[model samples]
Target: MRLLEGVLIVVHIFWLLSFLFRFNAKVKISTNLVAFILMMIHFEAEGHRWQMGLTYVLFIFLTLLILKPFIQRNSKKVKLDSENKKKVKKFCGILFILIYSISSFALVIMMPVFQLPKPTGPFEVGMTSRHLIDESRSQNTISKQEAREIMIQIWYPAEVTDDNQKIQYEAFPYEEWSGTMEFIFSFPRFFFNYLKYNESNSIKDITVSDQESKYPILVFSHGFGSTRMQSYSQMEELASHGYFVVSVDHTNDAGYTKFPDGREVMNRADAYSYSFNIEDEKDVKTRSRDVSFVVDQLTKINKQDSQKLFTGKMDIDRIGVFGHSYGGSTAAQVLLDDPRFLSGINIDGPLHEPVASSRLKKPFMFILDDDYLFLTDEEIKYTNVTPEEFREYHNKITELADFHYEEGIKNDTYRLTFIAGDHYTFTDFPYLSPLLSLDINVDQFHQVMNQYILAFFNQYVKGEKTDPILLKEKKVDEFYYFETNIKN
Candidate 1:
């Protein structure tokens, strides 16, 4: 248990004692002591000024109550003052009730709200993913390749009605996983307790009649060591607007993950225990194959499930892939290796894979970090990659790609450099805690990335009209830069 929870429990015990022993003459002194203790715990737990003010008021009242009898003891002892005793009992009873109720209420109310913000639109997303689907089938294969298990979350547009079909934000099975994440992120264990309240409609396996519509299917993979729902703000927003989005959580690589069955997978703590090396790239290739497995399953599921929303809505030809961090790198590799993917967008991942050196004919764009892109000619002169290696890496995409910087203006074309965006800024960490957002300015950074990503996918995948915001040179806040892929 966290220190906060322990303090809260102590406060509750003291308040209970106060309620039970309020009438005892000696108990009045102890009641005041407990009130002081409660006040101290409440002050530390809440840090809110109003809570402090209430604590001060309660302390004063308890102090007066403790003193009232002592100050009148001599005068009252000389006579059997029944009326005075009754009056004192009634006063103490009200005082104890008031202080105890306020303290209890504050404990319940002042605690933080912990939830990854749901998308601000109408969508019910349900996802179930399996990591390393091939491994389960490859029981006889003795290949020592590190295959990743994955958790997948699917988001879809739900029919809004009077009926409640809400999906849960965090499932019961994920409770222990949350505890593990608390340790990983250096947060208090109880920090995720409030996630219990994040209730939403579940994604029903009902069928849709949009067989003739041919909606574009979008596949999303989060960065390595991140949950599938890590980008909820962006994924939910996309689904709410009509696209079917599936987010895959790479097993062992995610902070926490649960397979479709009863199995759960967590991050490999030892994977990064020592010095980071090129073997990391091989692990990435393993993750890339997982993406292909998800796509393969979805393609088949879309064809077979005649009684589900995803039955025939997928326009396989209109499919696209996008991801952040290592996931971005995976998308790039998958697009290159798999012909099933038509278009791909990579956000802030370098092309360091050996296979990445091979040319990709696919129409893809890279939204790279500013620092990585603005490497000066002089810097390159000192580096191993000649202008030719850089050219081969950046100049091979078919539809052209944009290398965005944090300082560039938003452009109408698909490519633009964006500034102030950190690697983790494009995830759900911003909406979870203001402290986290301040630590990295995740809110402004992710909002900008999500907006542009949506616009980009909408234009190319759904054939929607390009928004003019894409062409404008603008800064949403102090922390973002934009850049685009260019044709060499």
Candidate 2:
């Protein structure tokens, strides 16, 4: 609960106690004053919806309590003829207080203040976001702009602070981020209001830790209609572990992209209107280009004379790329098209025709959800997939997996499937809300994901020996299946 909300609740409790016990005039007045002050504070602070509503009701009740003493003093008192009548009045008052107490306590408990799990890495994390415009490329007509624009958030290892007053974990302060999500997903705005309080384990623009001369770069792309901050937990974790992670928000494709100049770009309506029928091959190509352009910009930033941001801090030669859903396909395409990225990971994203058909020479990993696990025709029915659609979907996944396996025979490759994992599991959606994900241990899922991703990058990018966890042949409880083509 917020500070003001907590104060308001305490004041309400005091008022309830005073009313039931028939406290002295001075005590009643004190309670009323405190309640009114707390309510005013809550109003100014803009408490949660339930908190605000309850506070208003409590304010009215307290006002009536304060006026009761005045009314009693002015009006003639009526003596009850029978003792039973007085007892009945007292019983009713107690019953009402009981009911109110229970209801108010329930409301307070329901006002949830969700928090992100603390990152387990040794280093603290710092973040900064930048808007990059590719001058060489023209913006798509749907964007109504001149240059291709992308918003990116970068997370890196930071100096840990001992000051308790220092505000770590910077996040969206208001309803803007949640409002954009509600707009894209067509959900009630209040459903995501808690997101405004959601904070990552990363401070804003802290000085980079000097433990390492340079850190390996990891580029992340979000799923269709998702913002770069969608997978914030993962990015923060990676950064805490000494990786410089950059997450890109593809303008006009993401749900919302707010630039430094106060301009906001939303996903194009036409794009979603024809999404189902249109193959996302072009979209994949566009995102691939975006990633390539970002890589080029980072390279230039590393070599720039005046720019302090990431100057000489990026090990461009040890860069890796990864993404979720459509963005995952973009990662694979980037790896295939550009030789800059040493390796790539695709999280539950179907490979486009170009990527599936072509052979990849670099190390790669494919993390899949239960949906992509091999299924028989009879088993396919349980997946809620129509026969025709299942055929095409199954074939595409199989072909891509086969190609990856074949390449794995010559180069390092890994395929992992989580039986309980869903498409949204690859991102922070599962951790954000239980209703948005499948029935699975979200924390465990994240732990396994982070471990595997770090292991892959360690072995490929940093030339570290493979971790023992990655070498286990026996099926672990978290995974449905795990396969690797790397020769021992």
Candidate 3:
């Protein structure tokens, strides 16, 4: 909880305890009113969240207590003179406060309104979005006029000076982004209404940096049923280091996307995107086309930008692509199908079909989540599956992973196994809510991860000197496996 919110909660508890201890009427009334005032201050200053619902209710009860004296001013009141009655009153009041406090504290801890970490780079970050429609490809048959629509957002290094404030303030939408994530995770919609308090690091529609002639480009695709900005931290980090990054929201495939015109699009992909079969491959193939379309549009923008903000600024020849989960597979697909992508990275994603079987010619980094990489016999024993079914499912998944590791490692691939890290760790989600995010220290992990990412792209896409972090296995946080395609 924030400072004022925390203070209000503590004050409320004290107010309850004061009544139980037979404090004077003025003392009790004053404390209760103080709590009520603090709550108002918290609502206006720190912002009220649903987590404070119980706190609000508790304060209302105190308000009723304060009004009870006035309501019963004419009625005869009998005091509880017995010691047993006084003890019972104290016990119940303490118990009630304890339960309410614990419940409210848990909610605040689980879903906090946090801020994105600052990018550890020299330049500031600027962002902008574009709504794209592919006229040739029809998306929905129910709507006769609708076509394949995509939302593309870009982040780039920017200049912030006295004359030019390349930092345009953009309001964070509590319903839109939070609702999208809740839909993906099956959480109740509007449960995270407090997300509006979360601060974004990128400023919108800002001027691009001109410190260099042209900025190398990095294109991004999100995980299945995930929004493109779900991984905004990495985008900002890259942009702050002088890289122009564009993220594509595969409309109808993303969890949710709202265009400038107020049209809302939600995921139309199969619920089981990780089926590890031909279905998964077909999904990857379809989403890869969106990335391709985005790339084509960027090329056009570089030549003639309608916005008149960034014209001929993209270094098209030095382009790279990276993604997480299913989008990771899309990156591999781009490395194979699109020659414009000089390099790529895959974060904890399983590759499917021809892409899995094909050798990647470009330099690529494969970051794997090793949380379940190894399991003991007892750990393997299932809670809800027959041993045979478990073995088959486990074997097939392992075979899928082995294919990517063996085939991908045959080329110039840098494979890093994140120890105890999970799929969401590769993105900005890890820093959003500590309880739902990764177990790792998010800022530290991202600091190291961003360094390696910058080094890999710099070396392959820009033909720059390689950073030593990529030279061999080293430990800055925890021990994890690291290797290259070439044998030492």
> lDDT of each model, Cα atoms only?
0.57, 0.75, 0.76
Candidate 3 stretches with Cα past 4 Å from truth are 79-81, 141-145, 163-176, 268-270, 278-280, 371-410, 475-477, 486-488
- Model 2 CA lDDT for position 45: 66
lDDT by residue (397-475, candidate 1, tens digit) is 2112332221121322344455554555666554444544454555456556667777777776777886666555554
Q: Give each model a TM-score.
A: 0.63, 0.81, 0.90
Q: How many backbone clashes does candidate 3 have?
A: 0
Indicate the residue-level lDDT of 155 in model 1: 65
Model 1: lDDT equals 0.57
What's the residue-level lDDT of 252 in candidate 1? 61
After superposing all C-alphas onto the true structure, candidate 1 shows an RMSD in angstroms of: 10.5
CA RMSD, predictions in order? 10.5, 4.8, 3.4
lDDT tens string, model 3, 231-335? 877888999998999999877777888889987776665444444353347678778788888888888999999997678889989999999887887888888
Question: Which is the winner by TM-score between candidate 1 and candidate 3?
Answer: 3
* Model 3 TM-score, 2 decimals: 0.90
- Kindly indicate the candidate among 1 and 2 with the higher lDDT: 2
Q: Provide the lDDT at 449 for model 3.
A: 70
